[model samples]
Target: MPQFSLYEEEYHPSPLKRTWIEFRNSHIAVVGLVVLAGLLLFSLFAPFLAPYDPLAQNIDGLLIPPSWTVNGSISHLFGTDALGRDVFSRIIYGCRVTLGSSILLVLLAMLIGVTIGTVAGVMQGVRSSVINHLLDALMAIPTLLIAIIIVAIVGTGLVNSMWAITLALIPQFIHHTRSFVRAEMKKEYILASRLDGATNRQLFFNSILPNMIEMLVVQGTLALSIAVIDISALGFLNLGAQPPLPELGAILADGLDVAYLAPWNVALPGLTIFVMVLAINIVGDGLRSALRKRLVR
Candidate 1:
């Protein structure tokens, strides 16, 4: 009889592989992932994908309708804006601005918030107490209000507006991370680690942090949806991306002026924002469900 190797006798898939298998089974999640990927790819390659320069003006071709319309031309499929800039090109380029800025803002906020929250959760006494109280106070103020105040202090611009939004989002991450860490601390693994002579730093870095990864990923996705909305709102108010930049919010704001004669100007950008936010949310929900199933297993 042939001897079987131990590895072959007791084969098991890695957690990541298992989680991916489970995630792939969800139809909505799969669709959302596809849409999100398409958007990201389009944004990343906008320069090559766009037919015309988004900023170039054709004064004579201004306010043309979409190509499907009788007066529209194939050269400008989505039509031209008030300044005769290609609407399709601007929309394509705007994806980069909107997604890139929001992603950067989320990352910055996550780094600051997770660091502070983890420390507060692990180290007891006045420090933790103070951090919690500070987060509570910050949370009480509306996110938009906080963003507005920060924008005012930093002065107006696209980069500054992102900074403002990042500041406003930090408290949310801190709160969520703190709560997750505190809950994890009460679990049996933490006590087992302590009894096994594991140092506090070792336990946190090796054990606690690894388990928190899934929760953090879920929270990050959810936060992204909120970031998208806030960034657009700021842009609409003229506190974010400035003129001639082709930002979605700025595009929508400009469209408002010519909405009567060229409704596509307002409709297209507004619809884009709506679809982007919806796709993000659907993915977030699907991730939460998939991760929850993994935890249960």
Candidate 2:
């Protein structure tokens, strides 16, 4: 009793507070962020960073596996495709095509879906019911099948493929945002703000929408993973990213012949897509958790 433990204050920080800090400073979250940043950078700079043209082939080098040539040279570090193009370079460049189109589609879908959802959520009754049903029906359809149908009808080009993916993605955002906004509108803060003679537009834009921003941020991150998967499936089916374009799915399809013989060609691109999607999902989960904590605090 006489010796008041002076070290107690330093040692006994609140567990909840420490947990919150740890979540913010967590290793998985940090590594996920780094991985995402690196992928983005690689995709953006692929044209300059890649050693050789992804499409150029040396038939003389056809099917040559990766090994140091006796003359102090190597044909392809990751081996050659059936056509003898450098697999390493193609896989690197393919990241740009895979991610770029998927991102554009997701953004477009978000813009359209979020706008519609926001408006629908602010309204009620028949309008909301109608909108909800429409979204539900769209969601019921398989995304992959829809992509196949749209591409078959529209003809596969980069623009068309993006449009197809965007169309498929919009239903999900529409449903999510509308639900979030509708519930947020019933909160006491929203009612109080309205009681103060805030205009409907003002209430929506200033009160409701701002509160929903954190949720939207989380949704966008999760949506990116879906977009990547959808695009890859489309590309694999030959419904997206036409020939001469270095697409991850198409590259994987081409590598199936000798995948066991020279594994890196297929492995590199598939791994890139898998890691990107996984990284996005992990970050999204962290963001959702963090945002909920922020709301509680």
Candidate 3:
């Protein structure tokens, strides 16, 4: 029994031991997850914790250096924008816009892209041929440029902007998801499951989707980062998040003019964009690294 116990221990790890080993091997991934979680928590609690009304004007406090000075105050730690809105307050609120738009855009794009990609990748013959040609044409056009053009034509508002960005992202998602699905479809287990009387839905849910989940996770993270950055670029170009919404990109673009002096005006938004995008990218990197290690082990 003692010898058997040792053998069992070697053959099967306790859950805690498995988790500890995972943690030790994926330290950077853990840090990324922590940063991502922290930012998400901050965004969720912004309304309750913000010091001043993000939209309220305080010309008296405009662009004040962070307090602890004779004339300065701490109410607005990040200072104020041109209209005297509390920069700190607005920044906290600004995240709502950035993160919300990012999530919405990523989700919408993923749904459309993944569905099409699956259909295309699974079908061989005229179905895939037609889909592949269309995707190729769209891929040939520059995503950002096409996004800007579409936004300009459709008129600029949140809905229109989301549509434009979603359009920009659709091709990439289709390409990636199609490739992933196609590859998974060819795997022996998938073919075996199909031969063993699995329904289409079951094949997708139990076989294909489960296998592609890790790749999809990585794709979604990377896609969100790209979508957010693309949306911000459109905003900077004055196409998305039109005036009065406190968009991070427009704030930074406006900040560029006065960048010589009140650098924080732009810096605040720029930093927010940077950190949000950076958090997403970090998460993506971590996922990729973890997945690779998983493959190795």
Best by TM-score: 1
120: Cα error in model 3, Å: 0.5
The alpha-carbon lDDT assigned to residue 147 of candidate 1 equals 85
Whose lDDT is higher: candidate 1's or candidate 2's? 1
Provide the TM-score for each candidate, comma-separated. 0.93, 0.86, 0.89
For model 3, residues 1-297, the per-residue Cα lDDT tens digits are 444443444466654354446645767767767877776776789888788776677766566754544555676677666677777777776677777787888888888998888888888998898888988899898777888889889998767888998988888889988888888888899889889999767888787886677777788999888877877888888888876777777677767876776778886788888888887887787767666665666
**N/CA/C clash count, model 3:** 0
RMSD of each: 2.4, 5.1, 3.0
> Tens digits of per-residue lDDT for model 1 on 103-189?
888999999998888888887899888898999999999777888899989887899988998999999999988998899889998
Error of 2 at 80 (Å): 2.0
lDDT winner between 1 and 3, please give it. Answer: 1
Roughly what TM-score does model 2 have, to 2 decimal places? Answer: 0.86
- Candidate 2: residue 131 Cα off by (Å): 1.3
lDDT of 2: 0.80
lDDT of each: 0.89, 0.80, 0.78
Q: Score candidate 1 by lDDT.
A: 0.89
Angstrom error at residue 108, model 3? 1.7
Tens-digit lDDT track of model 2 for 1-297:
588775756455454454356456767876887898887887899988788899998888776666553422264676777888887788787888888777788888888988888899888899889989998999999776777789889998666777888888888888998998888888998899888999878987888777666767788888888888888877777778876788888887778888886676677778888998998888888777766665565
Task: Please list all clashing residue pairs in model 3, or write none if there are none.
Answer: none
What is the alpha-carbon lDDT for the whole of candidate 3?
A: 0.78
* Model 3: residue 146 alpha-carbon error in angstroms: 2.3
